[model samples]
Target: MIQDVLVLGSGSAGLIAAVSLKIKIPRLNVRIVRDPALGVIGVGEGTTPNFVGHLFDYLRISRRHFYELAEPTWKLGIRFEWGPRGRFDYTFSPQMDLQWGDLPRPNGYFCDDEFSNVDLPAALMREGKAFARQANGAPDIQPWHAFHMENEKLVSTLEKVAMEAGVEIVDGKVTGAERAEAGIAAVMLEDGRRLEADFFVDASGFRSELLGKALEEPFDSFGKTLFCDRAVVGGWERGEEPILPYTTAQTMDAGWCWQIEHERHINRGYVYCSELTSDDEAVEEFRRKNPKVPESPRVVKFRSGCYRRMWVDNVVAIGNSGGFVEPLEATALMVVCGHTRTMVDFLLQTELEPTPSMIALYNEQASKNWHEIRDFLGLHYQLNTVEQTPFWKRCREETDLSGIQDLLEFYRENGPTGFCRYRMPSNLSDFGVEGYLVMLVGNKAPHNKPHRVTPEEKAIWERHRTANIAKAKQGIDVKESLYYVRHPGWQWNDEIQAKRG
Candidate 1:
C-alpha cells in the first residue's frame, strides 16, 4: 500500500502537511526535505478565523505551545484605511447582516456616512481593544478571531510540533527529478540520494522546486486583476507604542502600507506596483512614511496567480508554490491551511493513491478557490477611490473585476440584504457574501434607489451601535489581554475548549 510521503521544504506548508498526514494515517512514513542554506521569508503573516479553528480543532495542535513560541497577538479584524469611507473594519463576524429587530432592511443602507460601529467586533477594532469581556472585567477568553504572527516563528513552531508527531525532518535540497509516465518517480537530491515516495508535496515557496520547475506546470497570471508585485518590508523594536489588536492597512502614495502588530515588535510593509513606482522610490516613500523603522527595508518580489493545476499526479503544490496573491486580506497562510487539510483528507479517502478523477476534482476545486481569492481581493481595488496617485487611479480605472461582476451588480441593486445569498458558491469560496458585503458597505458604494428606514428602525440601529461601544470600552488592549491569558491562574473554560475543537 501507499505508506510514505516525501514533502519538500520545511515551511509552514510542508510541516503542516507532514504533521496532519501522520496524525491522520498513523502508520504513514512522512519525511520533510529542507535546505538549511535557504531561509524563510520572515515577514509578518496573518490568518483568518478558519485557520485558528483548523489548527486547534482539525489538526489539534497545542494552543499553549503555539502561544509560547509564535508570540501571537490577537486580530479581531483588519482596520482598512482605504477608499472614500477612510477607515473601516472587515471583522470576523458579520457586521451588517444582523438585522436589528425586524428592521425594514439591513443596516448597511443607512451606514453610508459612519459605519464601523455596526458590529461589536468592528467597534472594538476601532478603539484598539480586543475580546468580548464578561462581567467583573477579568480579561475574558480569546474569541474565534485570527492572529497576527511573525511568519518565521510560525513555521518553526509547526516544525517543532511535527517533530513531536514522529515526522522525520531532514536537511536536503532537490537537484533533479527522475520522471515517470503519470508523474515523478523519484526526486534526486544535491548529495546524490534519490528519495521516492507515493506522494510528494511541493511547499518550496517561490522556487516551486517540484511542481513549477520539475513538472513544468503552466502558470495562469492574475496580472490583469491584481497588479501590485513587490513589498518593501521593515519593522522596529516595540517599546512604549500601544499594541493594537488589529492589523492596519493604510493607503500610501503609490500603493499601500500594512502595519502588523506583535508583542515586542511591529512589522510594516509597503506593497506597490513596480510599473508605477521604482524600488528606490518605494523604499524612499516607505522610510518617509515609517520614520521609526531602524534599518533599510527589504524588498520581496512576487506574482499574483497560481499554477493551472494544484494537483498533478502524485504531486500537489501547496502554499506559495501553488499560487499567490498580494498580501491583501492576509490570505497566504489561510490558503495553506485549507489546501493542506483538503489534500490530507483526499489522500486518506482515496486509499492513499489518488485516481484521475480525484486529481481532476481536486484541481477544479483548488482552481476555483484561487480565483475566488483573486476576485475577493480584486473587489477591494475595484471600488477603492481614496488615493488619487497613479497606482490607485489606474487601479480604479483599469483593474478587471469581471469575475465578481455579477455579485457586484447584485449588491448595487439590493444593497447588502440577505436576499442574494444563492448567487455565491457555498464551497471553494474563501469569504462568502459576508466578506463582500462588509467591503461594499464599508466603502459606501452607491445604489440607485436605497432602502428607506423608519424612525423606529433608526433608533434600533443607534442603540445597537451604542451597546457595542460600551462593551468595547470594557475590553482591554492586546498586550494586557495576552498577559492576562499567560498568567499562572489562567484556565480555559472546559466547555469553550471542547467546542473550539
Candidate 2:
C-alpha cells in the first residue's frame, strides 16, 4: 500500500505534485526534498485555461489571493507574428463553431483577412485592453482567458500552501538513491541522510534524477518533429508600455520570441534551434529585437520529449523529469497538473505495486498527451510563413504532422467548416477543434476549391467584427482592471457585464 510519498525538487512542479496528491489522497504522508541553492527559473509567464480551472476547482486556492501576490496580469491569448500575413491573434475563445446569424459557415472562413479582430478577446487584445467592459465600467475577466504570472511568486505561493497543509519541506539535495527489486527504495541526500517512501515523485526538472539517471529509463524523443533545443531568455521591467492581457509571439531569425506580460515587469524569451544558430548569434538577434533587455540572454538547453513511461515500478516522474517540450503553448504545468491528477486517481484506486495493466494504461495516457502536444506545436511551426530562415524553412519542410494529419486533410478537403464534427479521442488532447482552427486559419492554410461567400455573408462577418471592436473599446487595460478587482471593497453582481476569474 502507498502511504508515505516523497516529492523531490521544490519548484512549481514539485510543490504542485506534493500538494495536489495530499489534497486528493488526504491520507498520504507527503514531504518535499529540495535544494534551496538552486535558484528558480522565474521566466514561466503564461498558462492555459486548464491551469486556471486547476487553480480554482481542483486546488481550491483563493482567486483573490492569487492576484494579490502573484503579480499576474490576465492573458486573453497570444498574438502571433506568424504565417503569411505576419500577424494574427489566437484567443482563448472558440473560433471554429463561431458562426454568424444564418451563415453558411463559421466566421473563421472570413477571418482570412481580419483574423486579429475576429473574436471578442482578439479584438480586446488588438485594442491593448484586458477585457470587455461591463455596464459598471470595470474591467471584466473571461473564464476563457488565463493568466501570465511571475514564476517565482507562483512557486513560492504554492510552497506556502503545501507546507501549511502538513507537507514537510526538507532542504537538501538528493546525492544518491537506494534501488530495490521493483524500483527505487529510497533516496540519499547530500547531507548523508536516507529517506524512504512507498512511492516517489520525481519533479527534478530536467535532471530526471530518479526516473532518468537512477532508473535509466529509455527516453522517447520527438527531436525529428520538435527541434527547438535552446532558449535565450531575458526580460526587462515594465516602462510606459501598456500591459497587454495577451502574450506576443513574434517570429525570430531562428525560431520565435515570446513576449509575456507581468504587472510590474515584461518577460521575454527566444526559443531557437541551436544547430541553425549559435547561442551567441541567437542572443544577438534577441537583444537586437528587444533592446530594452538590460542583460545578455541566459542560454537554457533542453531536449524536447518524454520518458518511455512516466510511471515505472514504484517511481513516477512528473514535470520536466518526465518530459519537456518547448514553451510554445506553455504546457509545462499542464503536464504537471495532469500527471499529478492521474497519479492521485490511480493511487486512490490501487496500491504501490499497481498491476502491469494499470501501469500500461497510465503510461499510454501520458504518452498520448505528450504526443498530442508535440503534434500541435508541430502544426504551428509547419504552417508558419512569416519567416523563411534556414531553421523555419527546415521546420516547414521537415517537421512531422503527427496525429493531426487527418484533421488537416479534412480541412484541406472541406475547408474550415466541419472541424467541430470531427471526432477525436479523449487522450487528453488539450487543444480542441477551436485551438486547432485558430492556428490553421490564422496561418491561412489553403483549402482547395474555396467556396466564395456572397456580399451578404461578408456584411454579416463585418457587422460582427464591428460589434466586437466596439465592445472591446468599453473594456479596461490589464493594470487598471486588476487593481479594481483587488480593491478591498470590490464586489460583483454581473452576468450582464463582463465576468471576473
Candidate 3:
C-alpha cells in the first residue's frame, strides 16, 4: 500500500495536487500541511484557461457558482499599455480548435493593424464576436478566460473541495525531516508529531523547505533577464459600471501597473524596482497620479528565478517554491497548475525510476518551460517604448537576450510569429510565433532588414483586410454583451422593450 502522500503547502498548487491526485487515484490518502503562520499568498488574483477546464470541469464545478463563491470577475485577456501611451488587448480566442497552419508551412500570421495585431482581436472583442464560425454559428471556445478572485476565497473554496474528496488538512509548521539511505523517511512537524509519507510535495512558496533547504536542490536565478522585483497592491470597490472583461497592464515611469476586476472591486498593483524608489517614494508617486486612491496599497518584494531541480528523491516542489516570473500576464497560477499537472502525470504514468534519472528528466522539462515563459514575458520589455528613465533604457538595451533575440530577429526579417497553441507534453510553440511578431511589429522593434510581402500577397492581404474591416464593423459591441450578462433577463420582446432584473 502507498503510504500517505504529504503535500507541504495550502496554496493553489497544493490544493490542486491534493484534489487532482485523490480524483485520479482514490486509494491513496493525501494530507496537506501548512504553517498557520505561513499564509497562502492570498494575492494570486489571476488564473489561466486550465483553471476552467482542468480544475472546474473535471471537478464538476459551475462557473457561475465559482463567480459567486470567490467573488471573481471574468478575465478576457490582458490589455497591455506600453511606450508613451500605446495600448492593445490580447483577447481570448474562442475558436482555438481551428488550426491556423498545416504541418509543412506551420504558421498563420494574425496581424492586421499597426499596433501588434491589436485590430483583429480588438475587432472580435468589440463585436462581442469570436474569430471563426462553428456549425451553428455559436462560439466554439477553448477554456481561455482567466479569473480575478480574492486569493483567500479561492484557497478556501479549493480546501473545501479537498476535504470533500477525503483529503486531510493539517495546520502547523514543519521543523525538519528524517533522511534515510533510500530517501526522506518522515517529516517532523513543529508540534513534534512525525508524519511519514512515501511521496512528498513542497508548495511552500519561496521557502523550499523540503526540497531546496532540506534536500539541497540547486536554484537558478533569472534576475538578469527580467527586472521590477517589487510591487505595491491594494483593492477598490467595483463602481456602478458593469465590469470590463479584461485586465489592464499599464507601463509607468518605474515599471508597470496592473488593474484586475473582481466581484467586489478592482484590484490594482504597481510593479517596479526598489533600487530606484523607496516604499514611501512609491506611495507618494502613486498618490500624485491617482489622487483618487482612497487607501494605501501594501508592498511586496520578490525575486525572479526557479529551482534547478524540481524533483529530488521522493519529493517535488511546485508553485512559487519552484520559480516565478514577474506578473506581466498572470502566469503564476498557470505555471503552478502546469507543474502540478506534470508531476501528477509523471507519477501516474511512470514508477519511481532511479531518483537521479527521474530528477534529471523533471529538471530538463521544467527548465524549458521556465525559459519559454520567461522569453515570452521578456518580449514585453525587450520591445518596449518607455524612454522616460534608466529603467526603460535598461529594458530596451538589456543584453541578456536568452531566446527572445532570435524571435526578434526572425520577426524583423519575416512578418510575424504565428499563433501559439502548444499544450503541455508537446512543446510545439509555447509562445505562439504569430503573437510575438504582432507585438514586435506593433512596437516597431528596430529591424535592420524587415520582410516585405510580394505585390501579389500584398494585394491578397489588402482585399482580405477590406472585407474583414467591413465584417468587424457589423460585429456586436462587447460592452453591450457585458450588459446583457449582468442582466440576463433582458430581451427584445414582440410588443415593446422588456427589461427584467
What lDDT does the true structure give each of the candidates? 0.83, 0.84, 0.66
Report, for all candidates in order, the number of backbone clashes. 0, 0, 7
Regions more than 4 Å wrong, model 2: 351-353, 420-427, 491-501
Number of residue pairs clashing in candidate 3, backbone atoms closer than 3 angstroms, sequence gap of 3 or more or interchain: 7
Residue 227 displacement (Å), model 2: 1.5
> Candidate 2 residues 1-501, lDDT tens each?
888899999988899889898887788899999798986666566998878878777877667666666767788888898888878888888766577667777777777666767778888988999888878887666788888888889988888888877899999999988999989899998888999998999988999999999999999899989989999988888889889888899889889999999877888999999999999899999998899886667888899999999999989999999999999888898788888888888876775547788989999999989998898899899998667789989998999885677778887887777453464434485677777778888889888746587998888878888888998888899878978987887754332233553
Q: Give model 2's TM-score versus the native structure.
A: 0.95
Off by over 4 Å in 3: 57-68, 94-113, 116-121, 124-142, 351-356, 417-430, 448-501
Whole-model lDDT, model 2 = 0.84
Better of 2 and 3 by lDDT: 2
Candidate 1 wrongly placed segments (more than 4 Å): 425-427, 493-501
lDDT of 1 at 486: 84
Per-residue lDDT of candidate 1, residues 1-501 (tens digit) = 578788998887788788888887878999999787887777637788888877787877777777888878888889999888788888888877667665666777778668867887888887788876767566665555899988888888988889999999888888888887877888998999999887888989999988999899999999999989999999999988998888888888777899998888899999999999999999999998899985578999999999999999889998899999998899988888888888878887888877789889889989999998898888788788777888888988998888777777887777787665656644476577788888888778886657676788778778888999998888777877887778876655543577697
lDDT of 3 by residue, 1-501 (tens): 355689988988888888887877777789999676878776788766666666665655544445445666566677777753377556555221222322222113333334322344455444444332335433333355666777889898888878888999999888898886655778899889999998888888878788788888778877777877888887667677446566788877778888777655677788887876778877777666655566677888888878887877788888888888888878888777777767766766565233466557777888888877777777788678665687788877873666655555555554443433222223522335444544554465664443454566555555554555666555433334334434545322311222232
Candidate 3's TM-score reads: 0.82
In angstroms, the error of model 3 at 291 is 3.3
